[model samples]
Target: MTGTGFGAFVRRAHDAGKLVVQPRMGMSEPDRMRAGLRATRDARATTVGTITLDSYTRVGDLESAELALLEGVSLNGYPIVSHDLATTAGVVEGLYGAGFPIQVRHGSATPEAIFRALMTAGLDASEGGPVSYCLPYGRIPLSESMANWSRSCELFVRSREAGMDPHLETFGGCMLGQLCPPSMLVAISALEALFFHRHGVRSISASYAQQTNADQDAEAVAALRRLCAELLPGADWHVVVYAYMGVYPVSPQGAYRLLGRAAELAAGSGSERLIVKTVAESVRIPTIEENVGALEYAAEAAARTPVEPADSDSQTYAEAAALVDAVLNMAPDLGTALLLAFRRGYLDIPYCLHPDNGGRSRSYIDSEGRLRWADIGKLPLGGLVDTLGAPAITSGELLESLSYIRRKFDCETTV
Candidate 1:
């Protein structure tokens, strides 16, 4: 199936007023991975399948992945690159197509080999960004990542020669998964989508992971949509909301509540898709049944949600727009612009310890439960939002903020 098949499938679901939910599932054994995809496809929701890659494959350690496979050792995820083409193809043979599109989710800063293997397996959609996959996962130099991703995009686009329209999703918005604040997240996600478009990717999805405040997250997704619409004219693009990527709620009730809120956020914000987290997330790798259960639960929650109009005039939009404009103004090329943005601190992720990141930026959860910048660093949002004279976040306060959602939901459940 062509990559555009995935985007088309999602667009159809959204047009029918359905939210397309997907699982982050992968297993080492082909039979197990096939079973997971079958379960995801059969779940009681408008769904898609995901083949998440193993850590060894993610870091390009194919030798180790092959060794694990040969020794019959279990792996955390599917090692697509290490598995033979025919074996991976057989895993998705009859399951993947227009009706059940599958995406390979690999957290790789350098993904050329992964891309090649997936395309060979006839899968066209995948997620990851140069900035997102690089800093959070490892110490790969930002410049090197940019080069790697640029080549990967170009390579992916070649699928069009065989009548396939490959789809790429940006992981930029989920940076650090927690306290980086929404505006920065929105800006980076949009920037990465632009980067993909410039490198010849026509079908793209911009992602936003759920943050602390529901209201704030709603505003962030709206800003992301506006940015993509304005910048990516004539491109096939959509918004995807990821369930909270931080310290998940430990209790089943709390976890389900958090996932429910994420579903509502996706439906209310007019996002086309959602990447779900099962209740088992806080404890361990979820089973196929657990994943299907989460998908069904999220679908039910979303069905009950009414789409709310966005606050276009909100602070989130203004701040995010400012950040995007600042980066685009840096250079004509989006990749170069991103490199320059980080080099000059025009774009900085709060609390990110990567060497290329400008460490001056910091954030704190406000008393109102919203993420706010404590230190804006050299980001060009000086007058848009005020951080001047704000006190630095203390370590104790940071720890509390990191578990803010878990505490809020778990406490509510107990009460």
Candidate 2:
């Protein structure tokens, strides 16, 4: 069978009642990269391939990447820009098709060159957003990142002229991976999806990372879906869930159990795709076999997990809708609205250290293991959420909250 574009491929899989699983594997060597993709395609699950970019390429340091390639030094990920088009294409020449669409997962705030290289290499899908890619990853001014992403989106959409439908996933929901409340995560994700849609991207995916509480995560994902349906009038969109993105459990059993919970979250919440994390996540980068094992395990877990009824009237949905509406009312254009929202502290992320961040917001893990807002900053959720008598989270409490999942899962495995 011939290959299909990334968005269409994923839509087909979800429509066929399969939850697509993907890995975050990348290599410096072309042959090894090709092998990784091959393994993913051959794995015993519905899967997609990822070519994560190296650090130098992610920061626009092509010179260092080229030097490392020449000196035979191993970089963490595939340097797509430093490597020639022929070399990059050869890595997925016969492997990338409808059955296995490959996406470039680079965490670059300024990704113009990265997008250009991926498009040249015939890659039709990538993930990252202006705000989501910027604040947590680097010190690049939000304005600059916004301008850069605007150009990148314009460049990515041009693939349509060549009969390829380009796909972009928002990393907004997974911002900082943990500690932030579900309401903010859901709101940012929906806003970023709206940003992509406004920038002419027709095929889009909104991402949400699994937080501490399963029920809360389910509520958040449901809220995100509802917001997208109401906001994105005529766009092809889906929800993608990433396994717990904070500190992972150290034990093998704990890791597997955590991954299983993530798969269950995706299935129960009706998310179309899941990004799997291996058992070696806490120690080091996982091997090809480990990634494959994680993929298969998640697939098995998803297969038997039944979908739960969505709660449309939950607190998550109410708060997220408020945040999105507040931001949209800030300005005429989505990008400008985002910039103005951050500048005015209308959307503050708890515990995020970037200078662009308001830093006034703070969150804590409640007694029931649910993430709750300790301080809401200038966010417009005052009416929906009451932080009136919430105790301020101390440094000691913050550290413990950061490792909440790791401790919970690891302790459970040992017991």
Candidate 3:
């Protein structure tokens, strides 16, 4: 990804008082390590952290060695692990044993396992300070996930009712595979609309890994542009970019201009926050040093840029909202529209309006993979509304479902 706009966004975020925590995931090489080191030096971030694998982990013990080098360098501490109980337990134990106050991140394939891990980690972390578990509640069946979270909240409320410390530290919502192809820019925009309405979440810093080779530069930029277009809907929302894995830089000076394009897209989309990747990331994990350099380069570019808006109309917003309505309406009917979208391979879904009471409830993806909606007689009721609508989940109701979980746990709302 390009870095030109990233530095400026980081400064914007810092000015806005958002805590920037760049957690480096795949530090698989020395050049990558150098990149990350560079990013650290340039960012001057207040906190930094890295994930480590222990000897007993499915990977190996090299994680411990890696953790050692990162100890003094990173201000925040964290461990990333699988959804398994043993793995989560082992990683949490190892991090704590090292004497660093830390947080744990794990996918929620097995909520039971996560619940147990949280219980243990929270108890242990309490001995040091506030222990947190960054839960990607966004992946759950929204209705089911929200309901389960509500139940969990009831449990916490009951804990308080019983005079016990709830102690469950959670950050709700994560856009991991929120949209596939990972390059659907329009899908990203629709997703953002849904995100705000459902979760009431205003900001986040999420990351994704693309599968393009070093030579596939155009393909890479397209994917990124799609992401930028979708996620950066212009001034309405904000995001702090954090992509450190993959090949770290690209060819043609034009490669560097991609981030600038994304910035332009964001400006046009009305997005409020942004932090784009700076280094070429197709080859290896980035080192802090290289990461810093990439950010500097990106920062310099954003310093001299202006965004041009694409033409649209008030009717356009309504049309876009209609498409969203059609997709979200499918929830009650098994997402017939989403199934159609899948069949049609329509890349975008528009957000035309806010449903009367709240955002639409329930989003369904039909067997065909398109979002479905109720029929209003002969006319097809909903779908992607704009120039090239992208795939996304934008029902306000869905957003609220995730918000319910996030608020219950006091977790980070964005990312």
Whole-model lDDT values for every prediction: 0.93, 0.92, 0.32
* Cα displacement (Å) at residue 289, model 1: 0.5
In candidate 2, stretches whose alpha carbon ends up further than 4 angstroms from where it belongs are 1-3
Residue-wise C-alpha lDDT for candidate 3, range 56-121, written one tens digit per residue: 221223356345446533312222222234544444342232112232233332233223434443
| Residue 397 shift from truth in candidate 2, angstroms | 1.2
Off by over 4 Å in 1: 1-4
lDDT by residue (1-415, candidate 1, tens digit) is: 4544888899999999999999999999999999999999999999999999999999999999999999999999999999998899889988998899999999999899999999888888998999999988999899999999999999999998878889999999999999988999999999999889998998999999999999999999999999999989889999999999999999999999999999999999999999999989988999999999999999999999999947866899999999999999999888899999999999999888999999999998888889999988899988987887766788898888899999998998999
lDDT of 3: 0.32
**Prediction RMSDs, each to the true structure:** 1.0, 1.2, 15.1
TM-score of each: 0.99, 0.99, 0.40
Residue 327 Cα positional deviation in candidate 2, in Å, after optimal superposition: 0.3
lDDT of 2 by residue, 261-300 (tens): 9999999888999999999999899999999999999999
Ranking by lDDT: 1, 2, 3
What is the TM-score (0 to 1) of candidate 2? 0.99
Residue pairs with clashing backbones, model 1:
4-165
The per-residue C-alpha lDDT of model 3 at residue 342 equals 28
